[model samples]
Structures are given as C-alpha cells and as structure tokens.
Target: MEDFKFTISKFLKRTALVLVFLLAVLFVFAPSFSLAQVNTGIEFGAYTGLAQTDVRIIIAKIIRVFFGVLGIIAVGFTLYGGYMYMTSEGNEKKLETAKAILKNMAIGLAIILSALAIVQFVLNTLLNEYQAGPTGETTPPIGGETVCADCGFLGSVIESHYPGRGAMGIPRNTKIVITFKYDILAGSLIQDSNNNGQFGDTLGGGNNDRPSAAFKIYPTTGGESAAMAPNQFDVFLSVDKRTFIFKPKVLLGSALQDTNYTVKLTDAVKLADGSSAFGAIGAYSWGFTVSTVADLTPPQIESIIPTPSLDKYARNIMVQINFNEPVDPLSASGFFELASGDPTKNFQNINLAIDEGTKPLISGNFKITNQYRTVEFKTADECGHNPCGQTIYCLPGDKQILATVKSASVDSSNKPQAQITANFYDGVVDMAGNSLNGGGELRINGQNKIVLEPGVKTLNQWQAASGKILDDFSWRFLTSAILDTTAPKLTVITPGSLAEKIDVAAPLNMAFDKPMAIGSFKEIVLKTNKDFNINYTYFGTSYDALGQKVILPTQKAVRTTAEIAHGDFWQKSPTAPADTESAIYYPFAPSLLNDIYQNCFYPAVLQNSPRCVVGDISESNKLNDNTPSCFDLQNTNYEGYCSMGEPCPLVPAPHNP
Candidate 1:
C-alpha cells in the first residue's frame, strides 16, 4: 500500500509539473496576444475601439492572471493541507482544522470560478459584438476634413477621435490648413496690416521666393465652407511633406472687433493661363465689430453770412453767418443782424439757398439801404450749444466751425466810389456754435485775397463791384493786360453845315473818345492826323532845257474828255502807297481844287478854263498845220469856227478835250 501511495504521489507531481509548464507557456504568449489587441490605425473608429477594448481587455486579462495565480496557490494549499492532515495522526482538532482549511480552499476556488464565469458572460454579451470582423481585421476610427458650419470655422483630421466635427462648431482658435493644389511660395504670403483687402503695400504683388508658407486661421469675406483648419495653418506646395506653418495667438474679440479680415493664396497670381493677381481674384473681407464704437458729429454753424465792419462808406451790405452745416430753416433765420445802429442789438434775418452746381456754396441776395450798415450774425446748435466756447468767437481744436460774410451791394450813396473794400471777422461763431479757424485762405476769384496773417481768424465779407471783379479785371490779373469790354463809338468831325465848297488844301482833324495805342497805325490807311494832298509835278517850276518846267512822262497819264468818254481809267496801284494824300498834276494842270471836283479828271477840266486852251493846238495842227489864223478862217468858211490853236474849238473840246 505504501508503494502504491508513493507512485500516486509521483504521478501527481508530474501532473503538477506539466500544468506549471503549460501556465508558463500561456503567460509568455499572453502578452503577444494582448499586443495584437493594441494594434490600431489612425482613425476615429480605431481610437474608439482601442479606448473601449484596451481598458476592458487589459483589466480582464489582469483578473485572469490573478485567478491563474490564485488557482496555483489553491492547489499548493490543498496538498499542504492534506499533508498536515496526514501528519496529525490521532489529533482530532488538528485534523479537523486541516480539513476545514482544505474545504475553504475548495470553496474559494469555486467562488473564483463563478465570478470569472459571470464576467465572461457579461463580456460575451456586451463586448463580443465588437469582435474582430470575419476577416479578422479590426477597423480603425475614421477621420477626415470637418467643417464647422455654425461658427464658420474648420478642424483638422483628428485620428481616433469620435465625432470628428468639434463639439460646438470649430473653436475660434483652430489652426487652419490652407492646402493648395500646387506648392505655395513662402515669401508670397503677405500680411496686410492696413486691412485694405490686399496682401501687400503695392496693392497685389507679393514676395514668392520660398516654397511653403503659413498663417493664423481667420475668417475672410471669401473662402471655402468645408475647409478644415488648425488654430494656425500652414501653406505648402503640393509635396510629399508640409512646407511651412504659421501660428498666431488669435484674440477672439478685442483685436478683431470693427476690423475687416481678408486672405488669399498667392499661388493664384501664377497660372498656366495668364490671370489676375490679387483684387481680380477677389479679396475676402469679413467684418467684425471691434470694442470701440464711433460717434462723430458733423460741423455746424449758427449763421453763415456775417456783418461787415462799418466805415464812412458802407463796406459790405449782406450780413451773413456761414454755417458749418445747412441750418434748420426755423432755427437759423433769426440770428443775423444789421449792426449799423447798435453794436450788439441790431440783427436781421438772412435768406438761404444751397449752391448746387459744383462747389459747396450758399448764396442769398439781401437788401441793405444806406442807413442800415454793420451786418452781424451768430450761430448756435439746435441745443444752443456752441462747440466754440461761448465767447462769441469759435476757435479750432477738436472742433471745426466756419463762418463767411458774403458781400452784396449797398446804397450807392454809402458805397465808396473810388475803392470798394469789405471786411471778414476771424474766429467768427455760427448758429451751430462752431468756428472756422483752420484750413485754406479767404479767396477772391480763386486767389487768396486775405493771406490770413497769424492772428487773422475770421474771413471778411467778399467784396465785388462792376469793374473790380468783372471779367475784364479777371483777364487783367491773368494776362497782366487790360481788356476792353465796351467797343469804341465814332462821331463825325464837328463843323457848321456848309453848302459852299470847302478848300481841298485845308487839313481835316477828328477827335476820339479815348487815346489809342501809339504803334497801331499801318501804311495804307489814310487819315487827317499828318500828311495832306500835294502834286509832285507841281513842286517843279522850271524845265532842265527850257526856262519853263517840263512834264516828265509818268506811268499813269492824265485823262482828257475824249479819254474819259472811253470809260477806262481806274486801276489799283501795284504796291500799296504810304499813308499820304498826294495828287497827280499835268505841267499846265490846275493843282488846287475843293471837294466839288477832286477825284475824277473829267470835273477838273471844266473847272480849269485856262487848261482847255491847250487843246487849240490840236485844231491848228489838224485844220491848217501852219498858221493858227489859217485854221480858224477855213473852219469859219467850211463848218463851225475854230479858235486859233484851240483843240475842238467848235466841237465843244471834242466833248471832253
């Protein structure tokens, strides 16, 4: 029996050894299997699967290991308990205690088995459904580009995260990934500080020396709705790896309020086909309300046309207070006054009309008689508040108010006949309680009439007169010469009406309204101012050969009645003659004649009876050829009687001799 027991013990020892060996093998291989469970892809589902499986599996595996260790302990305890029980021969209490210990060990083993069974059942029902696919491949979490529709933000692909879209749209601080089809030149991405919807100082050009670039994520007036973004985004060329990324600490509200945001890809500047650079592609402008609110009130004045300073002669008629703005009709009219009688009390109502065509001008025609003089006006705001401290004068400093005293005609008696002048007040107040203290000068016809000496603040009334500021005056200033507006009129020379013939030798002098320029005369124009008619032939009295003067042949010949009957004598001179009234004379011609028979040679013949005697020579030559009496005696016997040496003696000088 002892031998049998010994053999049984050996067999039990071998079985225990074999179980220990198997447990060691399982422990060694279990870590490898667990590592397999940890394998995951860069995907949302993978992250979820790992999150869900890792903890549970690792915990259960740990409990399983604890159970395995406990099981070995239970077996060892059982053998030890039995050995104790055998050694307690005849000791009832000790044997009973050993049996109790053995019983407790068995009970503990049963409880562990039951609990493990319960856990396995729970895991089978809950986690088993999440088992590896039939292909034995675990699916990883899926992640991709996600856009935040609510806040116009985007998010990057977050692997292993469930609900790839951020919880509440994209966070304001997400970095944006601006991916391009082609690589972006790093230097090309320009940061616009002015926010003028452009990228660079030169409007659209950019530096494009580098391969990739990046910038902080921000909203723009133009962009894709579904693009994912990081808090900062990198712009990279199409490459195996990202090129550059920009990171910025984005202020959620302070910096962006009331500011416009815009952005663009510089790569668009370059394309296979020619394309527009920046603005053509369109800039993205997203407006945000900055913390600061703007409140600015336009300039204002009470009265625009103001009073002019008084003088012995009235300076300017119109009392105007040029308002900084178009005054409310009801509130504006009563502020003006004519300060002629009383310094502070006399004020008048002024008419108002906005100058519409080109420039900002307000014009009104006002009446001011000689008795009423100084024009004055005050400007006040609707609330009677004058931005120009209430000293009746407005100053410039944070405030802009202007006043103008437009000029108008005064009574003729009160206006200066020789020099018309007007005055404008500086730092003058208006109805809106504003003043004109700065900018530009008091100009007349575009010229700074009043140079605005350092102390001169108010612009005086603009003075105008018929000749002072007329078009002629303007032309004079421009060309530095006087221009005549009224044309010159002519009046006949004064003389008693005379029927009697006047002497042609008398000089005729005429008068004119104004003195003419000295050098304005020309050679061909004849006038009575200088030379008179005189015959050149009459100047010579004697001939070179004969004691009497001989007539030299002139290209223009004298005419007789017979020549006049042919009707061919008038002709223009080849060269224009100098301005002179000279007469041509024959040797025996009568040089002196009056207006009655001046121009044509026909009238002069009848006026000069002595000159007709020369024609008798023609009769003598034609009739007798020898003796003057012979010709006359034959003429008497044959036909009409001929006077000796007379041409056409009976034919009445051949009708024109």
Candidate 2:
C-alpha cells in the first residue's frame, strides 16, 4: 500500500510540472502569433481548424482545446478506476486505491470546466468592447469611416438648401429644395412597393405615395412630435438623384404669419447601396421662417460679365448673366442670343442676316449655375490655352458683339407666344412663373403707350415701333485680338509671410493680382502638422466692383481650445531654418489656385522653382546668411510681398542682423 501511494504521488507531480511548462510556452510565443495575424493568409475553420486572425479569438480557441483534452484524460482515469474497483474482488487495499483515483479525476475535471468558463467570459467582454466605438455606438469597422471613391462610401453632406438655415422672410410658396453631395437611394425617399430604385409617382396628386419617415417637417414651436404626415407633402427627386424637392399639399404659412418650420433628414435616408446617408451623424436638421406673402416679382438682370466698357475683353471669355433672383432653369435656355454686329440694328435685319447665314450668331451651349441664378454661354469654337490645362472656348476676336436677352409677346388669344420666328421669341420666366422684367418702359411702334393689359407685344414688334424692345435687355462689348494667357498671382497674404503673434480668431486673407474664378477657390487647402481643435468657417470668395482684384477670405478662424503641446519646445539646430521654430503652424498651398481664364499660378513647368511658403506667426525668426529675398521666394508669376518694378536683394531690411 505504501509503494502504491508513492507511485501515485510521483505521477501526479510529473503531470503538474508538464502542465506548467506547456502553459508558459503558450504565453511566451502568443505575442509572435498575434503579430503574424495582421498579414497572415492562413485559413481554417473555428471548430476543426484555426482561421481566426484576432489574437484573443485564437487564444480562446487554444485554451478551450487544451481544456477539452484534459477533460478527456480525466474521463479515461475515472473509467480505469471503475474497472479496477469492480475487478478488485473485495480486496481492501485495491478498492481503496481505485476510490482514491476516481476522487482525484472528478476534481480535475471540475477545475478544467471552471477555468474554461472564466476564459470564455473574459474573451467575450473584450470582443464586445472592440466592436463598439468610443461612444459605445455600433459604428463602422475600424478605419471604415473615411470617404472612399471606389468603395462607394461617402461622407454624406448637404451641399446647399433653399430657405437656408436661420433664414427669415422666405416666401410662403417657396418649395423646399435640398441638394446633397452624392446620389441617394430613391427607394429610401418614398414608398417603393416594387423595390425598384424610383419614385414612380405623379406630382400633386392623390396617386403619389407618401414619402418615408426619413424626411420630416414640423413647426418650430411643436418640434418633431407635431411633424406633418408623410402624405401631406410630395417629394420629387432630381433626374441626377442629387437633389430632392419637397412640395406641400397646401402652401406653407397659409394661416399663420411668419411661421418658423424645421426640416429634418434622418440617417434612415440611404445611399444607393443602402448605406446611411447621414453616416455617423444620424440626422441633419435646419429651421427657417416662412413669410405670409408669396414671391410674385420677376427676376431681373443683376450684372453681366465682360461688361460693355471692357473693350479689350479676352476672346476666349465666357459670357455670364447674373440674375437678381433664382429663375426657372428651363426658361434660361435658348433665350440669350449673341451676334456680332452694330447694336442699333433692328431685330428683323439681325434675324434676316442670321437666317441667310450672312452674320454668324455664335453657336454655344447654355449652362445655368449659381443656384439657377446665373447663365453662362460657352461658344463651340475652341481657342487659346488655359494654363490649368482646361479646354478654352472662344468668340470672334476684334469684333463688336451684341448680346440680347429675348422677350416673349402676348398672342391674339392673350397667351404667351412660344415661337414667332426662327430667331425671335421669348420664354424666360422666374420660378414664380413671372416673365423677366428687363427694367424698361412699355413701348409699341416707338411710342410710349400701353397696348393691352397682360398682353404685352414681342420685343421685335416693340423694337420696330420704337428703337428699343419693351422688356428686352441688350449690351455691347468688344473682344481683344489676344487671348488671356497670363496666370493669376498671389499679391497679398493678410497675416503676411513669417508674421508673428497672429490673433487666433483672425481671418486668413489672400488677395490675387487679378480676379480668380470663384469656383476654383476650393483648390486652396490649409494644412497643419499638430492636432489642433479649430473650426474654420468659409465666408465665400468675392471680387471688387471693378473685378480687377480678387480677395479670397477663405476662412474665419474660431478657436475652440488652447494650444496643445507634444513634448519639449524651442529646439535649436544648425540645419533647421527660422520658419521651423514655431509653436503653431499652418502651411498654404498656392499651386492649386487658378484665374478666371483657367490659368494656374504655379504650372508644372515651375514645379521645381522656389515657391513662397506661408508660415505660422508663432515661428521664431533668426537671421540666416542663406535666406532668400521675397522675390527669390516666388515661383514663376507669383509676386509674393514685392511689388511690380521693385528692386530685390539677397536679404531684406527686416531680416538684416
């Protein structure tokens, strides 16, 4: 009995030592396996093999397998003990040894099960935390929030909307228009019983289906609880699927005076691929006040590009007409006529000359932009070179150009006439269905007289009666023989280069030597190295009345927090420049800027040349012998801080030691 007990004790001691060695080895090598999982191409089933990449999942599986093997060993020991006891034939020592073995096996099995449960609980908790974001929301997978082009995932945003946020005095009849940055899923907008990506319903009719709850509208005082029913309003998606127009069954603010309303678009609105349109934001909402009165006034011409006084206008210039108010996009097409001839010619003679092919009416396509308030005419003839590598459209150089905005005449039946002659007609109207008021007195046959109420004659008839059309607007301009080949240059930077102690709330101002295209302002980017919490508000680009100089107040800074520090500050190095010794820094990229003629300031030819660097104000300035002058800092046509015809030196007076 004593020998038997000693043998059992030796076996138990060896088993425990082996188990400890195995556990230590697993822990030591587990980190290497974790690192390999990042780029591993291995594949295996969870039950039968190992396919999981996460280290935690892999460790859990390994531990469970180890415990399962131990349980199988314990069961084998228990069976062996039962067989020995039954075959002992009432021998006390043999039976006692069998009982001891059985008791130890049972304890080992219980411990194995308990350890497995604890490990599983720990792994499950870790996995749940990993899947959830910092805010405990079930967000996209790690690094999946970024907008990707080919991935079909975008940071969905509202580009613009009619009756803008906080807008007051908005016309009651104004339709709610929301333009999105990307195309949306049509089914998400309204009821699509067939599951097809289309609205498939008529406008302003009972047949139209109610839109989904993703879009909502309600009075400001009542909040979303008093939201209007989906059936009360009809939604129409634009042909491109980027814009949605919401038209209420009844006019807004019909009974109330200056009522405030809120419009909300929830994340339930989806992309074509069924992803949330609002992304992580969940919803977008804005409020506007609607006036009791409706918009009844006609849209008028506010300004025209290539003004009548600009005799040296570029031949490749595009004619732009700005309207005082938004007009119907359909009404703007084919109503503008451009011909080269004397401005005083009668409509009949001009039409005759164009019909007989004696005079060339510049053929071009019309594009309505600026929220349907500006019309641009791009001629078919291509000429000149745009430094930005864009195609240039041109008009006949060294010729007198006469531009006319045609007006319609009332027919005998008192209805607006559509087509009177090939080149003579009028259909330009505003969003409120009112005709264009070109700011001129009513005239017939060269006499100031009212022919009929709501039955105004055509511009052609009015021109024949008097020297001018009743409502037709005309302008004359001349084009130069030379095309605009000069690229726009940055003349001034508000905080100035290498400036110090700049206010945190000051606007970043940039002025160009010539007027730049407002649309191209998007290319100018601001970059920083540190993670600073700052909100930049875009104030939009603008030009002076003369249009000679363009001032781009790109952003108004709003400082939300104090400056952040990484480590030690104010390091001095022999190789480091004075510009690098700054507490806060922002770098400007002017290479992307372009002029109205599509000429780039820093063309590819000047990419290797020295360029001006807009540094932060907090940078320390120390005199360096190799420092370049303001002129030397410029690339190609960029003026930097130096004026035209100004002398430049290796070092400026301000930098002299």
Q: What TM-scores do the predictions have?
A: 0.16, 0.47
| Best by the lDDT measure | 2
Q: Note the clash tally of each candidate.
A: 73, 3
lDDT of 2 at 230: 78
Query: Per-residue lDDT for 1-657 in model 1, tens only?
Result: 345344444644554555456456545655444333211221123213443233445555665686687678668867877887899988987787677667766765675576567545543332222222121111221121111111111111000111011212222322222322233332355333334542212211222122122322234333444222432221212111112222223332233343323322332333223342222322211122222222112222221121111111111111222233221121122223222353222222233221234322222223211011112222221111111111112111121122333222222452321111121111222212122222222222334232222222222321123321111000000111111222111122222111112222322222122221111110011111111111110000112222222122101111111000000111112221211111111111111111100111111123213222223334333322122222232222132311211122233243322
lDDT of 2: 0.49
Give lDDT: candidate 2, residue 427. Answer: 46
Q: Write the per-residue lDDT of candidate 2 for residues 93-198, one digit (tens) a residue.
A: 8999899888777766665665566555554443222111131112232222211111111111554566665678877766676656677887777775334445
Off by over 4 Å in 1: 1-80, 89-104, 120-657
